[model samples]
Target: MSKKSYRNKIEIAKEKEKNKEELLKKIERLQKRINDLEKSLNKPQNIQDKTELYLKHPEEPVVTPTLKKTVVNEQILWEINNSQRATKGLFEIKGNYEKICSIIPNALIIADEKGKIIFWNKAAEKIFGYTSEEALNNDLLNILVPSEYHQFFKEGFNRFKDTGEGPIIEKPSEFIAKKKNGNNFPIEITLSAIEVDEKWYSVAIIRDISEHKRIEESLIQTHQKLEGMLNNAVNTLVKIIELRDSYTSGHQKRVSELAVAIARKMGLNEKKVKLIKIAALVHDIGKVGIPSEILNKPTKLTDLEFNLIQTHPQAGYNILKEVDFPWPVEEIILQHHERIDGSGYPRKLKDDEIMVEARIIAVADVVEAMSSHRPYRPGLGIKKALEEISQNRGILYDPKVVDICLQLFREKKFKF
Candidate 1:
């Protein structure tokens, strides 16, 4: 019961240890197979099949053809290695592209080469007032394109199919489109193309631009109304000045005409010319504050009277400053009497300090005042008026403005 029993117990322990070692080897092999399977899942199955062939026959070279194109099936493989689901093969998992189209805010419509709608997104349904079921497999022209544009769209589509290009592809274009409710509205569309298995498919990104168009039209109408009101107000102000001084009833009107012509001759834009004309029409508005006796004195005025006359510009500025104008009307009135050398009245603004509209008006004012009949003096004629501006071109008047004024009278035969 001593040495023999001990030996038998040692043999039993050795057998158990050997069995454990074999089981450990089997577990290692199983882990290596799992790792290989994971690596194969990441690679293309066709490439993996070729790799296996090369590994099995090391002496023979495997000639695999290079793949120039790939066909992406919409179907997704959900259960690759699961035995229970393998019988179902690869099933579609509800394509990502279809989901994206359904969720986007803008309308998306996909069509075949014959203009037959294949896919209509949710946004398309909302925009065109048509359900996806109603639009699918239908002719796009009959459903969405307005009757007036059917022929044009058909011609363009034919051209696009032949050349794989069109005026609307990859570029946004606006067109009048019809909805399911039979309402026609403006729409902006961007088109793109994709080739699938040798068949060309067109995708259209659409947006309803009816609201934008309405907003643009409204702004234009408001702008026109505001312009009309401004013109009426300006005419009323000119009439007020005329009422105060009967002798200068037509003086402002004549100055405005000449100022506009001179501005055009100087290559000023229409907007600037309009501003200059308006300022010239009311340039002497401050004269309404002067006494009638002083304005129509018919003789040389005294020093105090002359000083009072110089204050008209400042008074005109004060009167207009409270009113809001797109152009600097108040500043133009204040600076119209200013000179290039800072020798004029009121603020005595110099050169660039004076508003350009004011500078243009100053030249027109001198020419008109000198040529027209004033109560204090006789009409001096156009020749003398031209000489006055030509003599003091750079000193009293803007040189460019003076040159343009002279050219207008001499070359263009400009008349008030």
Candidate 2:
């Protein structure tokens, strides 16, 4: 080739090399711009002014200098805002939890799976007489639990560590705990379990129930005394009724016994049964107004005499209506003679009109009156009394009460 032609080829090669160098520099500048964009996207932005402006005028456009009215990567901005909000929420939750643990009235204790105390609150310090600093790092069983219960606690803790469950978790348990002063007292503890970073923690809420126990015991004693006094008053009223009718000496007492048994057999609650018994004991109180001659007469009662006798229930009501009784004593006394089919006396009250206690007493009254020897007639046999009730099951008496009464006689062999 000629020397001039070779030099021309070299010039073409140099021009190509210079163009390639300029292209590389432009590419490097573009890469630097991309890096600047990424940095700007990642760096935390002051969103307070923008947020306030947007909230104040939601329909207006945000024109903040930091965001610069240019289109930017929205996903990165959203992630940044979300992360900040999540971090704020987590910190708020932590602060609230600490506040709650500090202010709760009951002693709060937190321990790891190994029973090492991790958190002890102010209430615990007050209750166990140990400062929070003193309780931390101490074994919970050794510090709070009595020596006798240490083995039991250990067993429960082991079981809880394996299964995250124990008999004491999620339930309130009462037991004795020793204070720092060596005095033992009753404590109620509720335990809960939590998992943090793949580790188990136990939280115990303890309440010293000494005052509550003392108050409960005192209330029980007061209730017992009141019950005894009420029972004495009932006995005195029963005696008063007995004195009025000497011939039927223990009739009221026997009726009361049968009524109580029937009430219990009918599944009536204790309060209802008690009311029925007391009302039955004084059911004949109205008979006190009846002339002793009519009550003791051995002959059949004349129409006028029977009519007068029928008024005894109302007379008894009149006497008891003014007296205050927790039970419906006055109403039961007036309605005992009432039949379910409106055939009974005084008001001829139908089924639902009669008080439940009165219906129970009516069945008991009939059974006792039939089985016992009345002044006017010989005593009917128990079989005959049962037969009478069985025959009149629902017509004149409550079928359920009658059935219970019959069962008492046949199945339970109940006797006066």
Candidate 3:
């Protein structure tokens, strides 16, 4: 084919693709309107303001209430079970359904379109402390639903009455429900819309979740207690390190404070920030093995003594490695001296090879060590400490950690 003819074919194909896209967009818009119309159909129509609502008990002998009953005598139940309008779907009501509802652990209630109770199972009686006789012919909202939830029922019941559809159908939701003595308790309720002889009915299967909630609260308290004990153990280790090196008594704690602040400013999740805090608090644990004379030595230390000091990171790692922490605590301690350019001590790890936790502690360690008074020299001051990290941002330390540290001190007004 000629070049001009091929170009024309390509242009035609492009136009066809554009038309297909526009058609799909129009279909999506039409689908949204159809969904809105279906929702509107859920509004109530032709529902009576007052009607007899019956409450039936299929398990035991009948005690008929004289309230001009509108309910599930055997004929209405037969209508529900055998109606041409009844479709087999979620929570389908069938023959012997009342026997099953009566035996099930959950409380079962079936209300007519007007929100009047018609069926109350044996479990419902036990949960709500209402007999079938007392509960029968009563408005479901007035009897069992709490006042706070009345608005939802009023809105929802109308939709179910009109179109046999509502948000509460086909799924479970949690709410507070009223019991017999006027006490409110948590409940997990699953509702469904059923149609019998062209009339929509609302069916609910509710479970009292008071015990589940109590167990959840108990577990939270137990977790908090365990957290307290873990913190106490970490503090004891901090004290051990401080007691051994008097010149750096609060060094580990100050580093931890700064490291945590930097981690938070960097937008790390709380779990990771917590791990950094714990590692920073005990980063120098290996120094505990070194002689105190060298650790607290006055004036500048000899080369041999300085070499011994570098071994502290590995020493801290060895001691901490034996612990079974959920985080990489020992690794962070080992790499705290590591630099992005592989200039750090102990292992000489570089860049991405080092853990982020170690990177954060390294910056905190340097700032605290230089700013605080040491047995060998007077304090270097915070300005000089900031300059040290700023000078070697990417070369000696992590760039991101450095930037956040700078922001924490400069912009966030973070304190050690």
Best by lDDT: 2
Q: Please, what are the lDDT tens digits per residue for candidate 2 over residues 259-306?
A: 999888778899998889888888888888788999999999999999
Given candidate 3, what's the lDDT at residue 42? Answer: 49
What candidate 2 gets wrong by more than 4 Å, as runs, is 1-97, 146-158, 172-175, 321-323
The weakest ten consecutive residues by lDDT in model 3 span 59-68
Q: Candidates sorted by lDDT, descending order?
A: 2, 1, 3
Error of 3 at 114 (Å): 4.0
Better of 2 and 3 by TM-score: 2
- Strongest candidate by TM-score: 2
lDDT tens string, model 1, 112-175? 8788998788989989998999999999999998888889999989976655478887667889
For each candidate in turn, give its C-alpha RMSD to the true structure in angstroms. 21.7, 25.6, 17.6
Structure candidate 3, residue pairs in collision: 52-70, 54-70, 54-71, 286-316
Error of 3 at 170 (Å): 6.1
What TM-score fits each model? 0.69, 0.71, 0.66
